[model samples]
Target: MKHLSDNEKDTSRIAAALAEDLQPGNVLLLHGTLGMGKTVFARALIRALTGRPDIDVPSPTFTLVQTYDGLICPIYHYDLYRIEHPEEIFELGWDDALADGITIVEWPDRLGSYKPRLSLDITLSNADNDPNKREILIETNA
Candidate 1:
């Protein structure tokens, strides 16, 4: 499915709607350029999943992974942009997280040959008419 968002709030709403369809052990692979609002959408989805508007979802750029505890199921947010090798992901406990709960990964291309089947793929692109506008495409493999 395709979705267009006019602003951050719209993006969050779209993410929240998508969040309702997610289940435990699901993998969400997000692909987009820098500043394309991938992390923004992720934070919104995390909030929606936990039903906590005040929860702060930090970008896992440096930490590689961040875990959120208040949700019904554990949420593992991973940012592989800084990873130099796929082996580094194994060190970060990738397989264990996948076996746990929901996993939202950004820059999954960094995984190289280690591609896991994903429940959904979300790709974001810049809108031609507006800088703040984002064109998002969401597809479910299942």
Candidate 2:
């Protein structure tokens, strides 16, 4: 799927719509450069999954990962930016999250070869050099 988001609100709206179809064991890999709307999309998805529009969904940049209780199941948000190696994910509950949880990963390239095969990939990029406009592409390997 492809979409053009005019602003942050538009990006969040798109994420919320996608969140409606998420389920446990689902893995979402977000790809984007710094300053892109990856975190905005992630936060929107988390809020939608938890059924709490106003919930705090902070970026897990420092913590590496954050957990939240979702209406359908647990939500695992991972930021692999700080990870030195993909193997480091094992020490951060990567297995447990994959067993039963909706995992949203940012900077997934940092995962190296540890990336799951069956997962959804979302890529966000500036559209035509317009910082406020984002081109989002979503694909699934399911």
Clashes of 1: 0
**What lDDT tens digits, residue by residue, belong to model 2 across residues 7-101?**
99999999999998999999999999997989999999999999999999999999999999999999999999988989999999899899999
lDDT leader: 2
Q: Model 2 shows how many backbone clashes? A: 0
Model 2 scores what on Cα lDDT?
Answer: 0.95
Evaluated at residue 33, the lDDT of candidate 1 is 96
Q: Count the backbone clashes (under 3 Å) in each candidate.
A: 0, 0
lDDT of 1: 0.88
Question: How much is 29 displaced in model 2, in angstroms?
Answer: 0.2
